[model samples]
Target: MTRSLHDRHRAVLPDWLALYYREPIEITHGEGRHVWDASGKKYLDFFGGILTTMTAHALPEVTKAVAEQAGRIIHSSTLYLDRPMVELAERIAQLSGIPDARVFFTTSGTEANDTALLLATAHRRSSQILAMRNSYHGRSFSAVGITGNRSWSPTGLSPLQTLYVHGGVRTRGPYAHLSDARFIEACVADLEDLLGHTRDVAALIAEPIQGVGGFTSPPDGLYAAFREVLNRHGILWITDEVQTGWGRTGDHFWGWQAHADSGPPDILTFAKGIGNGMSIGGVVARADVMNCLDSNSISTFGGSPVTMAAGLANLGHLLEHDLQGNARRVGGLLIERLRAIGAQLPIVREVRGRGLMAGIELVRPGTDEADPQAAAAVLEAAREGGLLIGKGGGHDTSVLRVAPPLSLTVAEAEEGAAILERALRAV
Candidate 1:
C-alpha cells in the first residue's frame, strides 16, 4: 500500500515546518471564501492562507490576466525593459503616497523587507536599525534580524544591529492600562529614550498593525508621534505592509494611513495580498533612498510578466468593486459579533483588530496567563465545524487569527463567527 500524503510530507519536510492541526489538512481547491480539503470537507476559509488571498479565491479577472500574460511571455528578466513590470510599478508608485516614489519588485515579503533595510542602511550609512517589540517581518536572515518576535527569530547573529522598541502591542505591555492618548505619549517617550542610548540608527521599521503579534496595535497616531522624533535625528521610517496592505484593514488603504499626521513613510514594503495569492512583493521608497545603492542589483523572477499581470488585475478588481468599503462594513459587524462572543467566554482575553483582520486572544479562565492549549482546541474545533482559522502570538501562539478575504460578505462573516463561537465555547 502507498504511504499517506501526510506521512510522505513528514518524511521529506524538516521538523521545523509546522502544520496547523494534529491531523493536518491538504487544501485541494477553493472558490470565493470556501475551500475543500483532499478528503472533500468544505471549510469557510477565514485565515485566507495567512491573509494572502486579499480578493476572492479563484478570481476570474486575475486568473485570466495570469493566463493571458503567460501565453504571451512569462519570464523576462530585469535585464530588458518589461511593459507589465513598468505598468504595475507605475500604478504602485502612484498609490504608495510617497513623493517621487520608486518601486522594486521582489518574490516574497522577506525579500521586500530585506530590500527596505538595504535602502535605509545604505542611504543613512549606518547598520543600526530600530524595530518594534513583538513584530514579525519575514523569515530571511536580514528580515529575521529586525524581527523582534523571538519565536520566529531563529538566530541572534545579524548583519544589521537591531534595537527593539516598545508600543507595537497594546493590551499586554507596561503601558497597556493607559488611555489611548497617554499610551501614545508613553510609547513615544519610550522610543525617544531608546534613541538616546543608541546612535546612528538607520531606520525604524514597523508594521503599523503587528500581524503575527496577534493583530495588536498601539493607539492611533502612535507612529506619527514616533515620526516626529525620528525626523529630528534623520532616521528613516519603513512601514512593513506585507499583511496590512491592499485594503485588508478596511478603514485605511495602507495600515500606515491610520497614523496619517506624519505623512507617508520614507520607505514602504508590501507583499502577500497585492497578487491575490501570487508571489508578488515590492518595496516603494522615495527616490533619494531608493537610489542610494552604488552597485546594480536585480531579481531574476521578481517582476515576471505573469505575476505583474496578476497584480494589475487583482488591484483593478479590488478597486473597481470597492472591496475596502465592503471590508469596513462587514468587518465592523464581525468584530462586534466576536466581541459579544468573547465577552461571554473568559478564555477570550481580547477580541481585537481593524477591518477583516481580527484576533481572539486566549487565556486561562480566572487568570491572565496565556492558554495556548485553549487556542489549539478552538482551532481544531473550528476546523471540525467547517471553519478554517489561524493562530499566532508573541511566543505562545495563543491568539486565534480570523482574516478572511476582503470580499467576505456579511452572511459569510456571520456564519464564520457562529462556527467560531461554537469552537470557543467547546474549548
Candidate 2:
C-alpha cells in the first residue's frame, strides 16, 4: 500500500517538495497528541504537523466552529461584511501591541509576509531590506529575496535588495566567542555599519526564534537594541511571528515580546497555528503603514467566515485554558530532560530553544562538523519507536526540531523523550 502511494505521490508532486523519513508514512487520523498512519501504526507527534496544530488534534472547539461555519457559509470574499472576520480582527488588534492596529488576513504565512513586504516598501519608499543571517520568512518571490538561508532559497532573483546581518544564531557566527552582552553589541554595531552603507532601508524583518533555521534564537534584548538604531533611520521593524506566535514560546504570547523593551514592532505577520488545522494567516500594522497603498485589494479566500470562525474558536480556547502557562511548565521540564540526555551523548553538540520548541544539533563526536548522517539515523530509529520528530539547520540539516502542541502533557513528553533517548543511543 505504501509503495503504490509513494509512486503516485512522486508522479504528482514536485521533486523539490520534501517528505520526512526514508519510508514515509501517510497520516490517516489524529486525536490529542497522537496520530495514526495508514498501516494503523500510532506515533506521538512532537512536531505537531510543523507546529501548525497549536492546541491539539481534532480539538472540539475548533472542529465545532469549523463545522457550524461550513454549515452556514464556507466563504464570502472581502467585498462583503464578515462578522467573524471583524470580531477576530478586533481581538487580534487589541492583543497586537501596535498602536491603532489594523489586521489584513491571508490564507497562508507566505501571503501574509508578501503583504508585509508591500506595506513596508510602500511606507518607507525603498526596496532594500535588512534581514538576519540564517533566517527564513517564506517561499514567495518577495519572501525568498529576504531569506538568508541559502538551502531553502531557490534563486537569487528577488523583488527586494536584501542585506544579511548577524546575531540570529548565538552559537554559530563570527561573534560566537563573545559574551551575551558583547554579542548583542556586536550585532547592533554590524547593523549600524551596514545601515551606513545603504540608503532608505525599508525594514528589518526577523524571527524572534528562527524557526526553519533550527529553532535558534538571538539574545533576549537583541531586537530592542536594533530597534533603537532602526528608529533613527525611520526604518520599519517587521517581526515574522508565523511559527512563534500564540504563546507557544512558554514565556510570552508572541516571541517578539522577549525584546519588548523598545515597544512593539512596526509590522507583524502570523500564521500556522491561529486557526488550528484551518488555513489562516494575516498581517497586523498601524493604520498609517497599512493604508499606504492607494489601489484596492482583497484576497478571495483570506478572512473567509469559515477560517475566521476557526481562528476565533482556537484563540478563545488557547487564552481561556492558559496553555501558555502549561507550555512554560511542561516545556521547561522537557528541555531540562533533553539537556541531560544530550550531555551523555557525544553526538549532541547543543540543545537549544525555549518553551515547547526545542532543537538538538548533532555533530561528529569530538569535532565541530555537522553530522547529518547521524541525524538521519536517529530520525528513522525514533520513527520505529513510535515517535515522530523533525529536522532543520543551516545547510547540513543537522538540527533535530521538536515542537509539540501547547497543550502537550508531561506524561506524553516523557514518553517521547524516552523513545528519543533510545534512538540517539542506537545512532
- In the range 1-427, model 2's lDDT, one tens digit per residue, is 4558888999999999999988778999999999999999999999988899989999999999999999999988999999999999999999999999999999999999999999999999899999989999988999999999999999999989999999999998789999999999999999999998989999999999999999999999999999999999999999999999999999999999999997999999999989887899999999999999989888899999999999999999999999999999999999999999999999999999899999999999999899999999999999999999999898888999999999999999999999999999999
Q: What is every candidate's alpha-carbon RMSD to the true fold?
A: 0.7, 1.0
The Cα error of candidate 2 at residue 82, in Å, is: 0.7
lDDT agreement of model 2 with the native: 0.94
Clashing pairs in 2: none
Residues 1-427 of candidate 1 have per-residue lDDT tens digits of 9999999999999999989999999999999999999999999999989999889899999999999999999898999899999999999999999999999999999999999999999999999999999999999889989989899999999999999988999898799899999999998899889989989899999998899988999888999999999999999999999999988899999999999999999999999999989999999999999999999887899999999999999999999999999889999999999999999999989999999999999999999999899999999999999999999999899999999999999999999999999999998
Segments of candidate 2 deviating more than 4 angstroms? 1-3
lDDT of 1 at 117: 95
Q: What are the clashing pairs of model 1?
A: none
TM-score of 1: 0.99
